[model samples]
Target: MKTVCCCTVLLLLVLIPTCCHGGNILVFPTEGSHWINMEILLKALHSRGHNVTIARASKTWYIKDNPLYYKTFIVPVEQSLVDGDFLKKMFSVFIKLEQGTLTLTSFFQMAIGLLDKKLNIYNSVSSFVPALLDNVELMRKLNETKFDLVLTDPCWGNGAILAKYMNLPLVYNVRWLMPEEAHFAIAPSPLSYIPMTGSGLTDKMTFFQRVKNIILYLMTAIQSTFASKFVYQPLCEKYLGPDCDFNQIQNDADIWLMRTDFVFDYPRPTMPNVVYMGGFHCKPPEPLPDDMEEFVQSSGEHGVIIMSISTFVNELPEDLADGIAAAFAKLPQKVIWSFRGPKPSTLGNNTLLTEWMPQKDLVGHPKVKLFVSQGGTNGVQEALCHGVPVVGFPLVYDQYDNLLRLQEKGGAKILTLRAVDTDDGFLKAMQEVLNEPSYRQNMQRLSRLHRDQPMKPIDTALFWIEYVIRHKGAAHLKAQSNRMPWYVYHSVDVVLFLTGAVMLTLLATVMFIRCLWKSVCRRKVKLE
Candidate 1:
């Protein structure tokens, strides 16, 4: 009887927390690198005994059905948001933009061409919400699930729409919310210091740099307005009623699980609900595969250099590839290049080219000396987490900005894509990073700072996730500014109101003094 009682107590201790805290979480994630970040968070949620269900498009490129981690709520659509050849074409445009090789007229023409295709892709992605809503059976099933919250990446506007439609408390695994960075939407971003994405300016800026930042900020606002009005507004009006604002719906999310921290990002104003979990996906190095370990061991004292340009861009222009290969040929360090193309003619004996690589494992490896990359957020953060300095050739999107942060921190050396193809630029950048002790020292310092947090970033993220579930929603933490109109949020109305009040007071005093002077003059005339 005593043994059975003890066993029952132990079982209750283990089972009680799971029973109390475990909640149903519905995830609507973005594709590509964003999905990779979401997957890590989902796994952590699953391990904590939460039930995770993913509502993914039938034509999604990256998301796969995995019964162990989450159940799938697949929504079939006519078109895939991303197609195989789409990335190749997009890569070409990015390379051209980075190279600055096009004439002014040609650049605009090329940009317009790419913009049209991009809009089409956006249209395809936008179709997801309507398709889901029209599906009576799927809607019925999702309704019956009794999910506690909807976890989504607000990069795709449809997720926010779905959450609002479902009437579930929403949480975002966010970095970008469409037309601008997530911070621009939720936090106070002053153009004087907080660098806008693609500005390529740091927090500390010159007078002219601030002017440029303001211009970019305006451009981003215009773009955001355009996207909202054209892409999301009509959908919101048709489905959720005319008063439903897409931007407001996104802003009303219960929690913003920002995928960046001050370690990688500049210090800026953020909201209470915005939790930083920058390197949450990063973990200590696991052992490499036997073949990879053998090759890494062969590098010996000189160490290894690993290069990956991320999911897209399998091949570079022939000349650019040749230049990179030639540079690696001169390096004493062994190289592992994650590539998928016809091998470059100038490829070196020291370099190993594979279609794919274990990027996190290689980054964590003790023998890995340098990370040569395209400056994707995941790759850069992984390099930082492992204390590996970087040589970057930033292609497009936030890649340049991501590398700029590391360069400002003295942990990275960046070479423009065009620059790398010329005048030994690629080789020089590589050698400088490899030889510089400060680069490694600074990165290791950052690693220490990133690791010194009281709770692990993943744990912090999970806590906030479950915190929102337990509380039903984190509405108290959300700033009222999110719901306010633009004039009210910026205090423009208050400024105008105060200005008018002062003007009226001054006018009244002036009139009274004039009247008093007139009376005094009249009395003086009578006395005379």
Candidate 2:
């Protein structure tokens, strides 16, 4: 008994440190506000005693002085590819595309234009590779760190390459719901149900809509391949080694940390390699700042509508801003509007304007009635976290798709920039939301589900990251489908075999019938 006790205690002593002393973790997120939500997981890991390092471009160097980051590298790569002004231009272009009077052809033509702009940006931004490769000091510093694992964002190419360069296992941290490429990477997303984002289709797809989804999915695959071949592939070859390609580097990634949960997303198959940490970034709402608290309190019984737009929300078109203000004037609810553009000449008595507001805090407040937003993932998730019904005026990116998903879920309403043209139309929509019981009920239900998960999102996310480290990248969890060819993954060969068998059987039937008829005719002639 004494010997057994000693052995058990010795085993625990060895195992305890394995759990508590997590390894050196390196995070490589692209340059933007998109990294905000994802930072939650990284912060948690840092607090849990892991040494976390954030290596990013100079344009993306926004992390404050916190002990959470043990080291920070702002790799000066040419010029700032991303900045406040650049994002505003991109958002403005999307608003035009979303609000323009567009036919089917015109929509596609507009899409082509958008693609050209994105391609240019991607080319310029991805050129950071040459600079990073050129910096011998930076290379030496990264090599010496000896990170145990790398957390990657799928949106950019640098994370994948950096993982390779550092000889670390790659784990994709996707901050999106859908793109055909993501589906292919994580699991099989059937076209019969899963809709292509930005195609304006939902999970409950009509046959025609499914057809469009399939077409869009194929187009998306082609586009990813083209971009990779031109932009990322060459960089991999030039930086890592002669034979390396982007596909090869990405395929070696051990796991995926997808930012989605069933509370907001439709039912879909998930692989063991993929962990969904949807609301990890949603901290419990803090009290609103002094001035903002007073603004919400003034609403009294009517409650306030928290109106916000995109990151470039401040770039609202002059007329749209004025029209939105006009619509707010007709509503009974007080409006706390976060305006970025030129101030509206006619401000409503019930409306309070600010350059910025703590959006999550306002949404969590009991006095908040509805959220008028652009439907970005973080904004939408915040509203959902607080059980507030939504009104979306989505402009671009995944905003439109996010809104449609909410509309189908019965938790929100959709409005157009055009709808705010006159006060009456927008007022009617706001009133509809205010008066509707179903919207509030659905939102509350979703909010409860999101909050009532078996484990906190932060814990779940941290467990998996450590799990990867403990298991030396957890390669066993990676789906074999990742290695399968497209034809094999979709059973294309099986389909072709069945089709060919059917055609061959029909041919044999026809031949047999003709032979029998000819034989019958010959016998009849001989008998006659």
Candidate 3:
């Protein structure tokens, strides 16, 4: 009896921790920066005694260096093509189209959206489909290893499908402002018609701006619907199985983690399962290099501007480089530019060029007055977190939207690509952002609001991850409205239409009866 009791007690102790405490988590990120951010979240989880693993594309070099931190598994795919120059060129073209520069023919747009439903079937079918298939196979293999939950980048909807196939709960983590498709899927934003990040604040808009906004929204929706039908559906079906419904898969996600803060975005309704986990990437401050510190300090009363386009602008044109150099030459304050290749001879004595610099350290420096950036979400968040002003030159994707939000909030100035070609324009924009104290003060106020949230983003992410694992799938948290048909979900609209039809039919019937009675009465009177 004593031996049996001891055995039972030991069993309960082990089972309680396994069942109630932690479970294996698998993270799939679209790129290296995403993987790096996930690593930070995983470390936070690990500190709280949770087991985590990362299943990433082999192309991520950051993972190779930090083996000790994560149990890393590389999915089999051509890592070379993932970040190569060819992909960059394709991205550039995509951005141009997104910016309304390249005219999308109506026929081509319709074909890509509805019937072709495999995403540029002629072009991407040979290249991208194979890569997706290969990654799916790798995911299948990884599933055999047993994971309790899957965390996926919202951009990679295929990962959500894989999580469904594995019968594991999924958490969608968005690294940027949610695109319209993603916004609809996990957390339905109130401003469904608009492609812009947040609700449309039309109070400040002129009549012309309102009209333009509406037109832009309609075009964006039409184009996005077709793109998803083609590109997203094929990739999802190939992995999740032929029977899987792509629309349903998105709604089935257990939770959504947004890399955005209320400080930066317009207010909108959100669900409990949807969380805003912005600034998760901000970490402990590191000391700036002695030379860089000295350079900033040597500027005396004049403050320095830190300029970098991030990794996306690796092969900028010589003309662009010359324009940038010309702008820096005119600035009275010192400039530190992060350029990949050889320094341009046109750079003036006031400029310093390096292949790389510690970005966060530089942003946090006391003498660093302003930041001129490509306006990547992470870059903007970091600048805001440190209370630095910005001059945003957005290139692609959500960068433009972020820039608009920053500009609206008075924390930054937007310098369009058209302006970047000229020296005077770029110089003037930089000078305005740097010299103005309002930009810095507004950003600092926003930073405080972002930081004073109830919980750190990393902690919020980990809590939901563990919650899903403990519950075996947090189906309770998913919106029941997701399961309803489109007609049924919009029942109020349906009711209004039905009521109008009924009223019209009743009026018609009454008119017909009165006409019949009048004809009979007329015949009787004539007979009399």
Clashes per model (N, Cα, C within 3 A): 0, 1, 5
User: Counting only residues 3 or more apart in sequence or on different chains, how many pairs clash (N, Cα, C under 3 Å) in candidate 1?
Assistant: 0
Candidate 3, residue 312: CA error in Å?
2.0
lDDT of 3 by residue, 440-463 (tens): 999898888888977877787777
lDDT of each: 0.90, 0.78, 0.70
Model 3 per-residue lDDT at 268: 59
Q: In candidate 2, residue 44 scores what lDDT?
A: 79
Which ten residues in a row are the worst by lDDT in model 2? 176-185
Best by TM-score: 1
Candidate 3 residue pairs in backbone clash: 113-226, 117-230, 118-230, 119-230, 119-231
Q: Give the TM-score of candidate 1.
A: 0.97
Error of model 1, residue 154, in angstroms = 0.8
Residue 198 displacement (Å), model 3: 12
Please give the range of 10 consecutive residues that has the lowest summed lDDT in model 1.
81-90
TM for candidate 2 is 0.87
How well does model 2 score by local distance difference test?
A: 0.78
Q: After superposition, which runs of candidate 2 have C-alpha atoms over 4 Å from their true positions?
A: 1-20, 61-70, 96-113, 177-181, 240-245, 493-528
